[model samples]
Target: MEIELKPINIIFIAFCNNPKCKNTISIDVEEDTPKDDEITITCEECGNSIRISYEVDTI
Candidate 1:
C-alpha cells in the first residue's frame, strides 16, 4: 500500500514579551518557503524581537 501527502501552510502569531509593549506580529508560510524554516520578527510598538522555528514530522 502507498500513501500520498501534501505540504501545508502555517501561520504563526507572536506577541511582544515586553511588559510595556502590547503588540502582536503575524507571520505566514507559503508553498514557496521551506517547511522547516526559521523566522525573526521585531515588534512595531517596541524594540522587542523574537525568533521562531518550525519543524515538521510524520508519524
Candidate 2:
C-alpha cells in the first residue's frame, strides 16, 4: 500500500473584534476553492460574534 500527502498551505487567521474577549479564529480552506463572500466567527471566551466580508472583482 502507498499513500501520498500534500503540504497544508491553506490557512487563515482572524481575531475577534470583541474588545472584552479577543480570540483567535483559524480557518482552513482548500487550494483554488471559491470562498464565501462573508464569514462569521464566534469567540469562545465571551460568546461574541464577528463577521468578515470579502469582495472580488473579475477583470
Model 1 pairs whose backbones collide = none
| Model 2, span 20-58: residue lDDT tens | 766888766654555446766677777777776754343
In the predicted model 2, the residue pairs found to clash are: none
* Candidate 1 lDDT, 1-59, residue by residue in tens: 89897887788899998999889888777768876778888888897888998887766
At residue 50, what lDDT does model 1 achieve? 86
With candidate 1 superimposed using the best TM-score fit, by how many Å does residue 58's alpha carbon deviate from the native?
3.7
- Candidate 2: residue 36 Cα off by (Å): 4.7
Using all chains and alpha carbons, the TM-scores for the candidates as numbered come to 0.72, 0.52
The TM-score that candidate 1 achieves is 0.72
Off by over 4 Å in 2: 1-10, 30-36, 55-59
lDDT of 2 at 24: 88
> CA RMSD for every model?
1.9, 7.3
